[model samples]
Target: MSKLRVGVIGCGSIAQFRHLPEYAASQEVELVAVCDIVEDRVKEIANKYGAKAFTDYKELISSGEVDAVSVCTPNYLHAPISIEALNNGLHVLCEKPMATSQEEADAMIQAAQKNDKKLMIAHNQRFVRSHQLARQLIESGEIGKIYSFRTAFGHPGPEGWSVDGKDSWFFVKEKAYIGAMGDLGVHKTDLLRYLLGEEIVEVGAFIETTAKEFADVDDTAVCALKTESGIIGTLAASWSYTAKEDNSTIIYGEKAIIRLEDNPAYSLVVQYTNGETVNYELGKIQSNDEGGQQTTHVINHFVSAVVENKEPLITGEEGMKSLAVILAAIKSNETKTIAKVFE
Candidate 1:
């Protein structure tokens, strides 16, 4: 097979730092087109990657030269662009949270199914080597019957991080929807689900807009989750944390407790029931922060899935699962009760 021709939508921080660089670095992929609502940003990145530039993603997708496209646009545009690309016979790699609502997520999934094209969500946490190893340990019963866990993804606000700063669409309720829950919370929800190997069954959450000025979204959020297999846990996501903490997860079981962090070295730390403590630091695979190298991993997986006709670690359906948890958190915050997820 020839090199996969790729198009990138949204020339934002994520595209610049995560997907675009990885695509440019990938030997099996060709960065063919770049799109952004801001013409200058599109032009700049396209020139850097030596690709065609467009203000309209629709034009980029229809270029007929793209074998696969990465939907790096805002959360709101994820469903629409992914659906269009899939329908146009291009494989799609969309950013996280899948969609703001299940309806939109369902539509994206149906579009991929209808078009018979691959649709993957950029849930990079699943690609972390430590996360992969953690899953193996838990599944192998090395931890013995899992009972509970805690996970969090927190950092300072997006002002300096996002392209638009305080004016970024992320702070706008109309554009980004549910704030930190959608931004960081969804990642932890997905990570926990990946490690536990179970779908979330119920969620009770509290989401707040505590720190940022006029921020319509939650800066800090927390959720209690029950897994389909009866494991219970808590997940928290915050952009309001004063000191940065890369997203972290801790799992407790009959035999030991495991701690996993996605940075420095993606590592697993085990404190055994026998009073022995051991830390297995997994080597880093790519550049990553709180978002980790998962972005590069996800991009790599998307391209491989496109080329190999295989399923992605984070498929469109799996993306929806993570979104379901976030929506559950939102609903729980609203109703002040536990919301059932897959029920």
Candidate 2:
């Protein structure tokens, strides 16, 4: 079978570390082009992979050298690049927080639908082995009814992860639109929805700009969220975890409690009401730390979806649902009240 030619429309940390590398390693896709506003960065990445480089994403999209694209750009550019790619008749694999707002997300979805192309969001949490297993356990009634959950995705900020370091657009309110909440919080929102197989209906949050002096956006956010099924939970996101990363999730269920990415020895642990305990060595969740899981399941899954001519596991509409929850949380923080997620 002829491989799908892919262009990654951002040479940032995510593209360098996850999307580009994963595309090169895939058997079903070819890394054919790369784009970034920084010419040097794009050229460097493209040279490394023997792919074409473009400073402007629009040029790359119109180059017609790629069958698909990975929108690894910053928060604000997600919708624009993705919608452009979809309208150009290319499948899109966009990074998390698919858009800065619900309207943009809706536009991206509409573009994909109008073009009859697949648009997958890179919510890698749903692809984590422990998360997948946890979803299965919950679906099979192993954990019984879930009462609550607390899932956090905290790290030492984008300075440590982005290629541009502290100067990354993640610290800019204009470019990023939101801080850690948009960067990390959206992942947990999507994860919780996936694991519970329900939509987050409401969110209340306390978002603050207390950590980085260089950032104009909130560096920390703690939110209270409720699923459509009446499950309540807390979601925390921070760029102030200066020492280390904390990516953990704990779900409280009636028959058993499911703990994910909490223990280094075991990625998942479950304790039953009958005093039975099961530990699963599903491996650590993906992180920027050295020796962490090297490959992201996002690129592979996207390739498979395009190759099989099927919709991805996380569609633009699903991504829009997750983004709606985050937007509600932001609204809740601004208004100091619970905000219902817009359907």
Candidate 3:
């Protein structure tokens, strides 16, 4: 069996922690190239993965050795790099919130369609065991009609996560586009959409810069969303947290309420109207090479999908769907009006 050759763009924290390691661990993948604007970082990653290094992403995309590429770059670069790789006849696994704007996301989709290559997004929360179980429960109608919900993702800050800390692109609006909303909020947004199997039609948001002195972007954000099915919910994401909390969701239903959390053990807890509560331990949730290793699980899923010639658990369209909500939230914050997602 031939290994799938992969070129990874952006040797940043995400690429180093989540993607590069996962690609290395994949039985069906061979890391063929690593690219980054920072030459030293790319060289280091390439050496670590035993792959060719390039400062120019175009070189990696044009390199005939690569069958796929992971666009693990800053938020602004996600669409352009992914589209380029797809147009180059290579499969793409792009990091979320898909792109900086809906227009960019549309272009990426079009590029994938034009190239006839698979495009997946790194919304790894969809692959988490507890989250998946929650989706199954909702789909089974075991929770009855969901009335309202809340999803939140919080981390201390990206300073510790990045090699450059406050100097990282995360603090720059040009690179990150949006702050917590784009980085952490999009994860919960995607998870909520996936678990509920619903579309967020409208969103009202409030954004704040609570901490991190040099950061001009939002450090925290809160948004209220209305699903197409009339289900209402709140999504909160923050980098101002003193203590970290992984992704969490609470679903309220007629018969029961479901609660899922990422820490203190990845599990789902259900509370029934009759006052009976059931606890389910989902063991380990899929993660990256970062704190929880969630990215590893997500990357494995992408590789598996390619090797099996099947669609990934989170397709590019699904990623775009999640991005739609995030973009709507940003718009809502800007206009101080509830922005309709599909518009």
Best by TM-score: 2
TM-score of candidate 2 on Cα atoms, chains taken together: 0.97
Tens digits of per-residue lDDT for model 1 on 1-343?
Answer: 5899999999988898888989999999999999999988888888999999999888888889888988877888889888899999999999987888999999999999999999999887788778888899999999999989999888887876888889888898887887988988888888888898889989999998888877887899988899988888888888887665557889999999988873454377888999998878676543334453344577888888988999988888999998998887888889888899855
lDDT of 2 by residue, 2-80 (tens): 8899999988888878888788888888889999988888888889999998999999999989999999888889999
> Which residue pairs in model 2 clash with each other?
none
lDDT string, candidate 3, 1-343, tens digits: 8999999988888887788888988889988899988887777777878999999989889879899999988888898889888989999999888899878988998998898788899887877778888889899999999999998888788888887888989999999999999998988888888888988899999998988778989999999999999999898899877664556789999989988873465378989999998888777554322464554477887888878888887787888889888888888888999999978
Worst 10 residues of 2 by lDDT: 288-297
TM-score of each: 0.95, 0.97, 0.96
Clashes of each: 1, 0, 8
Model 1 ranges off by over 4 Å: 262-266, 284-295
- lDDT: which candidate is best? 2
Clashes of 1: 1
In lDDT terms, how accurate is model 2?
A: 0.90
